[model samples]
Target: MEQTTKNLVLASIGNIYEQSKSSSLNAGFFESADADLKLVSEYFGVTPNQALIVAMVFALNYKGDTVDIKDLTEFFECNPLKMLEYSDDFETLFNLGIFKKIKSTHRMKLSLANDQFIINQKITEAILLNRAMPVVEKERINDIIELIEELYKLGKQVDDKEMESFELFRHVSSMLDTNAHFPLVKKINEFEFTTTDTYLLLYLIWRTVNGNEATEVGRIAQGIFSSSSARINFVQDIINGDNRLISENLMEVVEAEFFDDTEVKLTANALTLIHEHGIKLFGKKKKSKDLIEPESITVKNLIFNEFEQKQLDFLYSTLSDENFIATQERLEKKGLPKGITVLLHGLPGTGKTETVFQLAKTTGRSILKVDISRSKSMWFGESEKIIKRIFTNYTEYTKNCDRTPILLFNEADAIISKRRDAGTSNTSQTENAMQNIILEELENFKGIFIATTNLSKNLDTAFERRFLFKIEFNKPSLAIKSQIWHDKLPILLQEECDQLASRYDFSGGQIDNIVRKAEIHEIIHGIGVNFDNLLEFCNTELLAKKHESNLGFSKK
Candidate 1:
């Protein structure tokens, strides 16, 4: 141990002992004896004396009380340098709200704001656990220990002793990773959950850990292979049990409303259960109502012609970060709408729906699939209510989501079709009501909305005006057909593929169907997918379409 460092440590401790006894030192006398202090301060930056001064302030007073620096020096029985030399540390602590001061009244004075017990406990840890402290400072560890003991005694008198103890050991043991995994977590793990209840519990936890998207009741019903009504009954059964899995008693569900149509997230208890037992729930988490799950297809999976591909590239670029930021910063400054609304119109199986999925996957957004059939209601005004609910859910969803999701209205012929003149019939009124709600929602819409339809001719002009980009997906060109044929059947000769492409005028979807049939036949017959088998499959597909009867008269 260096003689000078030892003297500085002992001297600092002596000063604190005098302060505890409410005595004062000769300030001018210690000012002349500051040589060794400078050497120690140069090495340590802030000495134990300074830490003790701050600790004593915290220990002796309540938060927000005015404390004077001059008073602190007098109370500590030391020259002002003992407290002033490390004023920077105190200033930093003050800024961090460990201590605070009034700007107008006595600016040099400060008051403690942070808990004294916690600070002392951390200081105790620094002395006990840290191996890097100089050996010369080892004898002075008793001073820090005495301060911690005093703080602990004071803390236990006013607060929960067990909780304070828990905080101290929990810091040392690293027991709680998050507040979600703390004191009450063991209560959930103690339950003996039933097999069915356990599956539901783990499934919710797994979704939260891996997928941040919202999970709806319909999706949870589908996941458990039960009807929605039956799923509700199952949940009720669990909540009614002695060891309730989804009850307020366990805090697994904060509200009863969460188990219904609302999107659900895992409660803190569920998270704790997964960590404690290490259970893995294997199912896709339902995306938030606005967000559709990410599509499995990438842009590379999209097989469009040169013109269509370029159009898609433009759409993708429009969704890029640079353009979005520019729109928010520049165009939005001029009061223009900040969102993009696109309409994809073409024949079925022409990749309109798949394109939406691929576009969402490429641009990193979720898709919200709007089912027109599901939205329809037999009751007079119920259909309009459903449509409005869709928009309301979407608005609520965006508030919680990280990225804006694509709202997909696939095969939207019913909604986008021309509105019939209003008559006294209930059906006509319901249709008009739904269209009105949709129009209003679109006008006010601020997020990405995409609608695809086979019959764009029937689309109302008013609805068409709302779309910023309307892309017409036509049948594949001859060259594209050849590419599709070759790509689907790599074993086929180029000449045969060219001949097929020339003879057939098929959409990508029809070609995909034909190829699938041919591949199946080849597997069953133990033969290569030859030209003859391909033609047979193609004829069968065309025949199926021909035999189908018209379910409704062609729209006027």
Candidate 2:
């Protein structure tokens, strides 16, 4: 908390007090102070003035006196000019309450009474503290302090007072300590506890406990903490804080909830935890089934034309072949190759990413998309580390599941583009290192890898030969586009689909976008599908494509 925050807190309290009086209701001074303190402590550290101002405002407003700048200045033993200098600090407080600015009168006065102020204070305090019990469990406070300590250990610099406050709260109460120390343990005992609370406690434990060993706890915590509602019911049963939750129960739960069969015996929870913490109680279990399977990526609603389907089928078959495996084995016997790069060159919006995704889906692999632009670094060797990390993750996943994960290098032209004289040495070096790492990883890789680039000619010839396959994804033919439009759009729009498809040389992705835009337009304007709206949408996409082409050319 800075002086500015303190002034704001005080101003907020004062405004709340005045508002309470006008409505003949009580304001929450304690609650307001606690909230202000928590926010300020979290963001700007602890400032005594902020704390002091809060205390003063509470005290003055509690006495039913109209809070003015002069009164606040006197209470703080500060000059009026000093208060005026920091007047802007109170604007947030003023907005939160119903404090009106008397621009014509030039005076600030409270329109409410004292009793209302006290009531408001009590309510606010109750809401802020979350309960009336002042003495929180000592262990809870310790746990919070310990959590802060862990964050500090991880190089997070937090305010000393913030840590101290949590410590103090924990010291005063037993239940709080019990709740904080072993959140998962105690949360299990709470009869009314929900999965959200269970996950939250797990998160708290992970945040508090810092170590490589604690990663399993973190992953288990994260699995239970996602926004996806579907996961809750699935992960519900084996969550008890008993021995059953650890071994047999977890295995059973995994089979029953996550996977259809027991052959793999690995649940999403188990996989997530194992990946993070590295198999804690159990010895590393070999994956019987592919962890990164094609079916894992939901594509049931995705519509594609025959041409797009053929391209996807070709890529999928190439990756899935026994020949590829034999080749990798032969390479390994001879000693691993430097890199195995597969390039998917095509026009923009021609399903490069979708094809990559489809391959990942079919091959049972996770696609770690490489953002080449962001990966480029000015600092020597830094970009290499980022690239290495991506490959390292892929390697680890492959090793864990006994299947190599797919690495999707999107926008590869940015990295693999032919060297230009204008680019900095740093840029060239970074690109070379990225290419080198790709080469190194692929040479020994038993898994599938794909890179999508719009500009095939921009890539180095040496790099091109490293790829096991180079697939060219061409724009959909007019007939293919017509079929895509007919299949994707509503049944009522069938007659118009052929005319629309003939009008624009759209790719599969572009056709999808056109339909999506039409749907949005229908929803917004409350109109049926019309030629004018469809044409406008097509024109919009064409303009966007032109703009991107111009930008790409300009960059070159």
- Each candidate: what lDDT? 0.58, 0.51
Worst 10-residue lDDT window, candidate 1? 106-115
Worst 10 residues of 2 by lDDT: 110-119
Predicted candidate 1 versus true structure: per-residue lDDT over 1-556, tens digit per residue: 4545444544544454444544443454345434434443443345544445444554344344445565566665667665556566665554333344332232211222212222233333333343223322211213322322333333232232222222332222221122224323234335655434433444455445455434554454444532346556655554344335545332232223344544445544454344344433223335544446665545536578888888888888887666756765675788877668899998787889888887778677777788888788775566886787677556544544566777788888888788887886776677778889989888878888899999998989988888888988989888888888888788888888788888877888988898788768778998877788888777777785676665557666
lDDT of 2 by residue, 1-556 (tens): 2336445544555554343332311134334445554543333222423333334455565577545555565554544565554344343233323122212123222221110111134323543544431222112224433443433322211121122222222222323333454443343445333434333333333432332222222233223323234233333433333323344322222111223221112333433443353223222432322233555567633445565567556656655646447667777778766234578888998777776676666566666566677676665665775676566545545555544567677878866677555366666667777777766766566566778899997887666667877877778777667777777765536557777777888888888888888788889989867777778888998997667766634552
| TM-score, cand. 1 vs. native | 0.48
Assess the local accuracy of residue 108 in candidate 1 as a C-alpha lDDT between 0 and 100: 18
Candidate 1: which pairs clash? 214-288, 292-367
As a TM-score, model 2 comes out at 0.45
If scored against the real structure, what TM-score would every candidate get? Answer: 0.48, 0.45
Candidate 2's C-alpha runs over 4 A off are: 1-296, 300-311, 318-341, 421-425, 490-495, 525-528, 543-556
